[model samples]
Target chain A: MNSMTSAVLDEGKVVLETRQLTKSFGGLVAVNSANYRFIERQAHAIIGPNGAGKSTFVNLLTGHFPPSSGEILFKGQRITDFPAHKVSRLGVGRSYQKTNVFPVFTCFENCRLAAQAQLPTSMRFLRPAAMYKEVNERADWALDLCGLKSRGDRVAGSMSYGEQRQLEIGMVLATGPEILVLDEPLAGMGKEESERMVGLLKDLARRFTLILIEHDMDAVFSIAEVLTVMVNGTVLESGPVETIRASKAVQDAYLGDGAEAY
Target chain B: MSRLPRSLSILLSVAIILLGAYPLFGDVLFPNKHAFLMQKLTGIMIMAVMAMSLDLLVGVAGLVSMGHAAFFGLGGYMLAMLSPEYSAANLWVVLPAALVVVAIASAMVGYLSIRTSGIYFIMVTLAFGQMGFYFFNDSKLAGGSDGAYIMVKPAVEILGVSLLNLGDKRTLYYVGLGALVGVYLLLRVVLASPFGRVVSAIGVNENRVRGLGFDPVAYKLLAFTIGGTIAGLAGFLAAIQYGFVNPATLSWHHSGEALVMVILGGMGTLFGPAIGAFVFELAKMGFESVTEHWLLPMGAMIIGIVLLLPKGVGGLLLQLFSGRSKMEGGQ
Candidate 1:
């Protein structure tokens, strides 16, 4: 068993790993010594209360914020200082907590732009957009996956709030990333929409490594294979869903009376 | 209504073709009046090229540059300065030289200016344009504030075989029309390509585009360079058309006029800027003929157009043809 552990460590099975990742804003430390690992093709949930630095942590991981200290490794390669575009091109895709999308563009155009980014010749200026068959195919597939295939013609700005959120996920998926870091995918979602998103997350977990940051305990617990709880810019607990559910510290701090409801 | 109509594209192509061939049979249609009209046509064509170039930056790239006229004037100044009275410059030599110089200058200016966005981008560009204006205004090397007049235009001479005469009004008119058509076709190809999509994406949301694995800065910078280069082409035509170069060409007022042309024509449409240029020039000429205080009527007309037609002439045309109030698929 010890030999197997060493071999797994040697092989670097963890797709994304952060060692002592830290971030500070003026005097306040947003993320302090955040050492985390996300394994391949697994669903990991980062759950915490408001102001718990969960969003800051995601921002650091995506290079939207420079870490105060520590290193980040993706597949054994250090990517601590990689810009968001470079990180994305390295097969790490993400969706914003806010429903951030190309509002002025059509849903199809939004996905198509994302899909085009994944292609080898995205910078080619002479070739027409219609000539890229694979890019369009990927966009179509993503739109269908997000239940937005029929609404592809509609302008994204005109879409309902729930539909816009769905389009956000569709865009991320279209980029053809190996790892998906979704920030509050279910925020402001109604019961039916949340249920639909949960199903989509579960399906996505089977194909791509997903790191979901969410506050909804029920949704997180249902879709998460591994859970990492954070509070006050530090990890409270990290383990399987059942173990986290039974933890006394988590129950007292975050779950409160909602633990029994779950 | 719902989709970009197929007939619109056909109509645009036909319109462009007719405009190009108009000068060919201009004499037959207008009789002796062709020479007088061709002069106006040449001016219209040059301004159209500049306006279209501005639209590339404003419409597609979402970069509102207020110093675009700097590039236009710089191109004209290059020809005027280089081909002084001592040595008359050849058309082949002067044109490429001006393009190269403007390309380099634009790359430098765009590199610095594009670092800031929104209103900052506008301000930075305005500063650069005024700097160019002042530089020319103070320098006696290019005839100082009064500006320099090109004694001789760039003559097309290939191995002592004269092809096109720039001295002839009709030939110059044809050349200007040809250049406009070339620039239009080139932009059409670019807008249909992947780079154009990236530019469009940046316009919508730069951060989202960055998250999708494309650097918005690079695409925006490329667009700035392209826009600048086309404006330079317009400047080259202008210098040849007027046989002069002036500081006023690089003024912020000219830049504002170009923006007005773009907005009045239609923001993102390829053909809109050209139409805007035509309307603007024609309006000025027509109004001047009618009254001494033409600015009053002209300003009112422009304001009316802006208020009544939010999408400008192009959008109105689109709505008329499609028979729909809501025009879908912007650009």
Candidate 2:
């Protein structure tokens, strides 16, 4: 009750807070003693070099797998032990690093399946799925939000790579999540696709909290309000985007001379 | 949403009509040995129903269940056990009872088996079938290895006014036809439902389903349960046709044969397996007449079909008639 009240009223408070979160695979400590408090409705970005465990950290935060030790609190509720679906039920939507959508289904159908997950159950057996106007509307809303409104009838597998990537984000949007964790949403897109995605991300930041893992420094600087740089599974630097960008330590250890490209 | 080309759709309609009218016109169609052909067609229809049921798991859900015949056997055994020793049992009563029992049993089996996938899933289901076989084979209460009998068969009666009688071979044949059509329609309805859409999506890619927050396990378990209950219906009809139930009914071989029928006909297209079942049974009969060692030639025939037609017989028909690529089964 207390957490719910706080979550509703306090806009400045953290929406997703993880403490001492650590995960190890055999001898490799992929995420080591990491802590992050994501402010409600803020677009935060996590950036790192390859092998810094950005993807693994996203995996833990989304409950794709359980952490070896730690607690993940959402809206002040301890959800460390929750499974992936349960976490989704609590309104944490995550898009994969790779494009993931129901390939055989139409783009609208793909989002509808995600929207249906918000219901108590899909045990809905007899009446055809098309009759559910609300689900269809939600699916439409997702497609519209992701700029794929015209492609609702096209089979997802038959779609272009950029459109499928948009559909992936659209599916997450349909789930009606409070937080969006996107892993490399622009991994393989050309400049045109990337610009459109950045526009979509900016539009999304107004309504929901976003945690993005991006390698494109141009997109990172334009969209993210704050930046956290990770190195060897530990937070090496974090602050306002410009502050991190200008930091001498950040530049020496990770960003180095390459950040000049930005 | 999945529309087969116009040519294939017409063919499907014509096939259903022919099946529905076969019994009525059997005398004129196969005048030389109408009775013999009727019996064979009836058997094929029963096997087709069973094959269609397993397709829910194999084709739509992309789950390979090797113990599907266990439900088939259980359906037959349930009928035998429910019927009284002397007079015919109430069809309305025993049919529902057998279905309910089979539903619960399959739910349990699905719960255990759905946890595994690929080869592990196949082996687990096969093991479950073997367990059922051994249990019924050794138990004296079930008449041991010799099996049990219905004796009088079931009849549909409303306040003693008889609607149908199973003892009449003609009546039984019609009932089997109804069962075949009813099961087919029910599966079609389910495949279009929200629950079913998620299931097919899981078959295509479970990782994406999970990303969308749909529990793959729940959908799969329900599908397995439904498939099992429908297979039970087929088994009940088979038992009534033979008036007997035996351990062999639930054997692994039956599961393998049903799987072959599903794959040979076409996996996803529901009509394919039904066609496959008719073709398989008829071909087996044809081979047996030519030689006693029909197994050797039968093996060669299946391999040749599978190799030549990668999508099975249904794929060949679709390509020849519609000139379309692989298409989904439902509307």
Candidate 3:
């Protein structure tokens, strides 16, 4: 019992930890008893077949939906039932799978707004916000980082799907979160777009702890340091790429026939 | 120095000069016409300012409130109540005191109402507004249902010369215009600010704003309070203009009227509400002159506008202007 307790304590060093986190929507159990840990500042990829509760897990971590039972610890602090805004303030940022953005605003304005959330007061109505040098500088920096400097003036809804995805990630990055959970960042992109996103993710992983949910095996294998495979609301396997590739359990759950091939 | 377009700026300057000269040259054109027109203009201007304040929340912030008239009525009644007791008709004292009281009242109401969104927000605001109406109606101290009448009007004692006497039609008109212009300028500054962008972003997608690290609720509540405060200012002006404050001032119908004005003019645009207020008031005046059942036609017009022009007259004007610009480019 003492040894088990110490093992749990060791896992606490990770940026995010879930102990028996579960969620049910009336008749359907969206996420079952799931114990998960993601190491600090490391690229952790959660790959799974359809209806594996991966999206549900992301929602739970980001406070989009409350968990039925369990505890979510972020950097040793329990935030299992924190509101979405509180979670964001506590260094948890997430991107929706469905490309959520302020459609009417310019890309720069969108990024600036995202960055402004960290400011002392977003409620200063009388002061001229455009003249705020720090906010302008930060917005410019975020736009440049996301490769949207030239397209900053363009409205978000008018942008191409790939650009919107990039902007979505840029929006998350502007929040300055220690933990970034991206839900299928490369959902509906072509080969080149996927590769570009993978490169961006690789760059991002160096500074921020990343939890990426992806169906794109090539992208996942290329970037992930540690991989977690979920199957039917349960984590089927979790290990390094090589171990995951060799494991028959992982093969049957996720990477079908010829397990060691990848 | 380079300036705004020649035609637009020239037109605006000419209009202002003409309006300023109207009072001076009053007796020359149709004798009593100037007084009647000025009086009508003042009422329209006050209503326009009220509508614009509501637009700040309904249009920009995407909060549909049905209790806004409570603040307006409260401000007006407070001024009416205090004016008689204190004999304070100075703009500096009465205006600020009324505004401050109304703002505090609005803040309290907004704090409670902002907890619920969508239909709940609308219903909650409506509930609070009704409460305000009942309180004023039952209060024997302020004449209860009979309402209170203001004997003194807000005036600026400028170097022994009374600049804005509410009794003087021409003076009242200028004051109303000045208030309208001030509100418009203030709104323009706010809409262009970062806070404005944040609120607009909230309107577009609140969840995104949250993920970006903003507490959308706090910003929204602040906007609600500001909107209520401005509406109260308009109410204060209205009470002084009419020399009366009654239960009708705080009614849901008044709230609906303000919303209609916003919708008729334009929701998101700065000067749209003013345009809407003028059009609505003019339409009502025309309808009343033609038939006794003016409400039927007015209601039909509002319904028609809501159905046909979802973006309002300002949006339609914007579309026309943009289209014209495109045609000019082609030429």
RMSD of each: 3.5, 2.8, 3.9
**Could you say which candidate leads in lDDT?**
2
List the candidates' TM-scores in order.
0.93, 0.95, 0.90
Evaluated on the second chain alone, the candidates' TM-scores are 0.92, 0.95, 0.89
DockQ for the candidates, in order = 0.76, 0.74, 0.62
- Candidate 1, residues B252-288, lDDT tens digits: the string is 9999999999888988875787889998989988999
Query: Candidate 2 or 3, higher lDDT?
Result: 2
* Superposed Cα deviation of residue A92, candidate 1 (Å): 0.9
Tens digits of per-residue lDDT, candidate 3, B84-185, equal 554547777788898899889888998898878899999999999999999999978688999998887766777768655677777677878788888977
lDDT of model 2, residue A115: 87
Q: Which lDDT tens digits does candidate 2 get at residues B213-292?
A: 77789899999999999999999999999999999999999999999999999887787888889879998999999999
Q: What is the lDDT of residue A104 in candidate 1?
A: 75
Clashes of 3: 0
lDDT of each prediction vs. the true structure?
Answer: 0.87, 0.88, 0.82
Better candidate number, 2 or 3, judged by DockQ? 2
Tell me the spans in candidate 1 whose CA falls farther than 4 Å from its real position: A1-12, A260-262, B1-4, B24-34, B84-88, B323-331
Binned by DockQ into CAPRI classes (incorrect, acceptable, medium, high), candidate 3 is medium
